[model samples]
Target: MQPIALITSPFTDKFSIPRQPGLAPSVISTVSFVGDFDHTASIEGIQQYSHLWLIFEFNQHRSHQWRERVRPPRLGGNKQLGVFATRSPFRPNNLGMSVVKLVDVVVKPQIKLVVSGADLLDQTPIVDIKPYVPYVDAIPEASSAFAGDEPNQLEVCFSATAEAFIDELTSNAAKSEHYQNLRQVIIEVLRQDPRPAYHASKQPERHYVSQLYDLELNWYVTGQCLTITEIRQQKDF
Candidate 1:
């Protein structure tokens, strides 16, 4: 199927994205319609809904081979399960779905959607969009098996240098709202502890780097705390 839109998000890399949507609500994204689907009429009345279900493709792994059984990060990447039982990207269809909060629907100049709590990587292709019906979509008694509970959150802290650096970055005039919420966004993302599941036991003291927007995050986890060691702006090539 052809793509209906593409996502513009701060998560340039999959390494640090939250395992699930709404895990980092402060991170915003734009869903810009593309090709033949770039007409405002296609999404009339979409603004009435507070949330949407985005059907997207794992375009980054389009060329990769699919396996019948895969290891899930939630299982510490140790236990293997059938591919259909997990949400691993290495699937035969390479499709993914997420429920995102619809911040706004822009119809002028070009059709676009301002959404939040999206875990999609930058430029992920969207196949379809559907309004979220709370009555039917939410299952109060649903059982999620081993993934029933939310992951534990770590206490995210910033170094004095990291705080000052964030201040300097947001101090400039004409900055966008996303720029102003940089600190909180970083905190929300880090609190999820964006590390490989196995690393918690194997490489607890390792330093890690992740890309968010135009910035490079330098962080480390110790005990139940995660610290931002540095934040650097990536230079344009």
Candidate 2:
């Protein structure tokens, strides 16, 4: 498929992103068209729909060998499920589909689509965009045996350093508005504990660093509790 656009997401690395679309509505992202795809005519009437279906490539997750069975993080990584049964990125096609809430469509010097609640990695190439028809797309009878429920939550607390860091960022008039909203982003993300399933229940002086927008998140987990040790702009890292 031809590339239509690329996503600018806060999830530069991947681990910090939500497991699926709509899980992190606060983490807004943008879709900018490549070349002629930016023509306003291409997106005519696209904003009429409340949500859109994104066909994007899992470009960075290319795999050398295909595996018949894959470990699902939601299953605690112990049980193996057929690759076709899970949304594992290591596939032959490496394609991903997501439904995201369309916030707005901007057209001026360049055309840009602002959307919320996407799980795509930064710089993910988009193949196509389609409006979601509620009549057919919202299937009430759909069910997933294991993936139906939301992710388990962990208690999140910010360390003194983390709190101070947040204050420092939000205190600046230049970035206060954005940083204020980012506080919850930190809690919600850490509350889900993005650690690998195999690393569960282990706290051996481990610290995880992740990025969101221009901020860098440094955190650690203890039992069911997570503490944000620090959060600073990407430049300081």
Candidate 3:
């Protein structure tokens, strides 16, 4: 299906993206509609809703091949489960659904949506948007099985370098609000620990460097504490 809009976020890459929505609540993103859908008529009543369901594409996955069985990171990435049983992206159809807080809906000039708690990668394509109906959507006795438990959160500490970089970023006149959320998002992201499930066993011997927006995050695991060793702006941009 053709995308009605494309979403933009600070998550420039998937390497450090949150596994699901609401995990990093401070991170905000926008959906700017295009083509025929970028009009007030298409979303006349959108602003009334407090939350929306987004049907989006996994545009960054290089392969569209289907995997009948998959290992889930939540299950330590060791046990194989049927593809249908998990939210594996390597499915027959690489479609994803997420519930995001409807921060605002702007209809004038061009259709745009402000949302929070989305797990989509930067520049993700959105096929559909629907208002969330709490009466039907929020079932009281839902059984999530393995996904019922909350993910473990580690202690995150910012070093002097990280603090300095974040302070400077928030002082930017044009992009202060966006970067202001970055610090909280970073803490939430790291608290949940961005390392792959397999990499957890090797954390003591390994170091990681990933990007969020134009900043490079240098971090390592020491005991139960995850330290931000350095934070630098990427020079490529």
> Best candidate, lDDT-wise?
1
Clashes of 3: 0
Off by over 4 Å in 1: 176-180
lDDT of each: 0.90, 0.83, 0.86
Q: Who is ahead in TM-score, 2 or 3?
A: 3
lDDT score, candidate 3, position 186: 89
- By lDDT, highest first, what's the ranking? 1, 3, 2
Model 3, 111-190: lDDT tens digits are: 89999988888889999999999999999899997888788888989999889888887888776865757788888777
Clashing pairs in 2: none
Per-prediction TM-score: 0.97, 0.92, 0.95
Model 2 CA lDDT for position 202? 55
Shift of residue 20 alpha carbon in model 2, Å: 0.8
Query: Which 10 residues in a row give candidate 3 its minimum summed lDDT?
Result: 173-182
TM-score, ranked from best to worst: 1, 3, 2
Off by over 4 Å in 3: 235-237
Highest TM-score against the true fold, candidate: 1
State the local distance difference test value for candidate 2.
Answer: 0.83
Q: Indicate whether candidate 1 or candidate 2 has the larger TM-score.
A: 1
